[model samples]
Target: MSDKRQQLIETALELFYQEGVQSIGINEVLKVSGVAKKTLYHHFTSKEALVLATLETRNQRFSQWLTVQIAPAKNNQELVEHLFQSLKGWFEDRVEVLGEFRGCFFINTAAEFRDSESEISRYCRQHKSDIKQVIRQQMATYADQPDETLLERICLLKEGVITQAYVAQDMSGPEQAIELLKGR
Candidate 1:
């Protein structure tokens, strides 16, 4: 992507995460991003299009970051541990890949777009499914393959972590998730 387009996405993502997508406007994004209206419209066509681009950009950044965080593992178990530890880091707002924690972007965005059939909500669901797929892939290795049920459990725990951490200001979700992993 061109620098202008990337700048717009980044600026929009930050604002959308800090505020709500419904609360932000195209002019605000352009102003914050320092990109002209013509440039933004030329690149995004519409505000919703820009929002989707930000979601995609966030997904790509998160997936790449998660991949790198789990790279030191020697086995699936260690991989899972690293995954939770990564979340721990994220919860503490220590991870640079994601800036300040403002809850799960997907969750926040989906809440803003309440209609599940809406394009934005659909994209959020797809991003979540993609995250679960990543976890499944991470836990699958030549020596041992985790069952689907276990994968689902872990995914649920991961969601729980994100939700509780954001909703209740609880930061123990990662530890709880790690404990769940230990029981398997």
Candidate 2:
């Protein structure tokens, strides 16, 4: 990626996370990204293209982070703890002495632009599906449990933890969720 295009993606992500995706316009991203209109257009044919790029960037970062987090775990139990600890770490990082922190950018964006048929929405849906698949794979490492039941339970718990931690401002919510999932 060109420096200009990379700047646009990074700046757009900051603005989108701080504000919102739909609320912020293409002109705003261009202005904030410090890229000329022609440069922006050269990289993205339209605002929807930029939006899809932004979502894909976020999805790539998330997948990379998750892969790193779960890489060291030996078993499903350790894997579950690693996942919860990662969420807790996010909470500790996101919440400083200041006010509340912004929640999951993807979840926020999905809510703001719910189920649209746009390319951005399609990328968002694919990212979510990938997330569920990751959980299913991890759950499979636990053996002895029915695959369907474990997949459903773990996916639900993961979603609940993500929402409760970010939206509900419960710092320990992810850890609590892990315990709940283990009990199940």
Per-candidate RMSD, Å: 1.5, 3.5
**What number of clashing residue pairs does each candidate have, in the order they appear?**
0, 0
Tens-digit lDDT string for candidate 1 (1-30): 799999999999999999989999998987
**Residue 71: error of model 2 in Å?**
1.3
Candidate 1, pairs of clashing residues: none
Q: Return the top candidate by lDDT.
A: 1
Which portions of model 2 miss their true places by more than 4 Å?
94-101, 137-148
TM-score of 2: 0.85
